[model samples]
Target: MPTVLVIEDEPGMAAYLKTELQFEDYSVLLAYDGLEGLQVYEDNAQVDVILLDWMLPKMDGLGVLRRIRQTDDVPIIMMTARDYVSDKVAGLDYGADDYITKPFKMEELLARIRVVLRRGHERATYQVNDIQLDTKAHSAVKNGTFIQLSQREYTLLLTLIKNVNQVVSRDELLDQVWGTDYTGGTNILDVYIRHLREKIDDDDSDVIQTVRGIGYTMRTAGNDN
Candidate 1:
């Protein structure tokens, strides 16, 4: 059964939603506020989907959504009382897979959940260089040995793996792994690259290659192609 995380602040709303999802045979996790939601998310990194409420205490749903997107593309459905087109567009721009307005039918909500889960499965199956990122398990391995990673490290590695053998610029890495709001400077990317090299490239010495001045490339060393 897929695990679904419900980040709804209202007790009644959260409980009802959880009941419905549980009836559908999904394992559920709940967070009453966005800050706690984030903590739960980081801990339950393997959650298959998130049902988020727009207005949340501690941190808003959008903030939490933005933070989660910086590290993983776990499927998300933003649940909100706000129904404006701008609200929906903003949620999508921030990486929400779908948006559902308040007072929605259980059937409609379930339909949207199925749709996002389908797409999430496609991403979960993607792999490169014998290294498979098990999105459902929230972990990765190369030739079967676990490749340990920090949250940011996993994001960076995933980005490189997704575009394997291509030159991915520092700006793109910063935007994708750290999000657009990151103000940490280019040196942070360099730091992450060094750390990743130590882990993924430790034995081979050629997994991730620096393109110098541009960014980096993920490929075997000494292969011109």
Candidate 2:
């Protein structure tokens, strides 16, 4: 059974969720406040999904979501009474995998949970040397040690690692990572490349190689193509 970490403040609602979710055969964990919830997540690495409330104490749901996304890409569903489009967009843009307004039926919530779980099962991992990137978690591991990454860094690294030795042009990376609607120079890309190098590269060698006139490529073997 998949484990779910629920971060809801109300006692009655939280208990109710625990009961219903248990009936559906899911292992459940609960935290009444955002801070406590985040701690629970950090303690339990096996948690497969999160049901985060909007108006949590100590820290709000969005704050918790942002914090978690910086290190792990765990599937998070924002549960709130606010059903506004902007609210939903903001939640998603901040790294929420799904959003459901409050007062929703248990069946619908369970269905959404199933969706995220299925997607989570589809997650993959890529490796080059000691570095590894998990598709679902959006996290990197170097020499078996966790390397926390920002969302942008994870996306950029994923793009290169997936293609391995194949050169990924700057325009392609810009469009894929920054989106087509972005109106900015490639300076940000270069800056992030530097950032990635600082974090992922060793003193003697680098996994990401610049293609000079083109873009970048990740090398698993020799420096030369």
| Per-model CA lDDT versus the true structure | 0.85, 0.86
Maximum-lDDT candidate: 2
| lDDT of the structure predicted as candidate 1 | 0.85
The top-ranked prediction according to TM-score is 1
Tens-place lDDT per residue, model 2, 79-138, is 999888998898999999999998999999999999998877556778988899886665
Q: Given candidate 1, what's the lDDT at residue 177?
A: 78
Worst 10 residues of 1 by lDDT: 119-128
Query: Per-residue CA lDDT of candidate 1, range 48-119, in tens?
Result: 899999999988999999888755778999999978999899999999999999989999999999999876
TM-score of each: 0.71, 0.61
Superposing all C-alpha atoms, what RMSD in Å does each candidate have to the true structure? 3.8, 7.8
List the candidate 2 regions with Cα displacement exceeding 4 Å: 121-128, 133-225
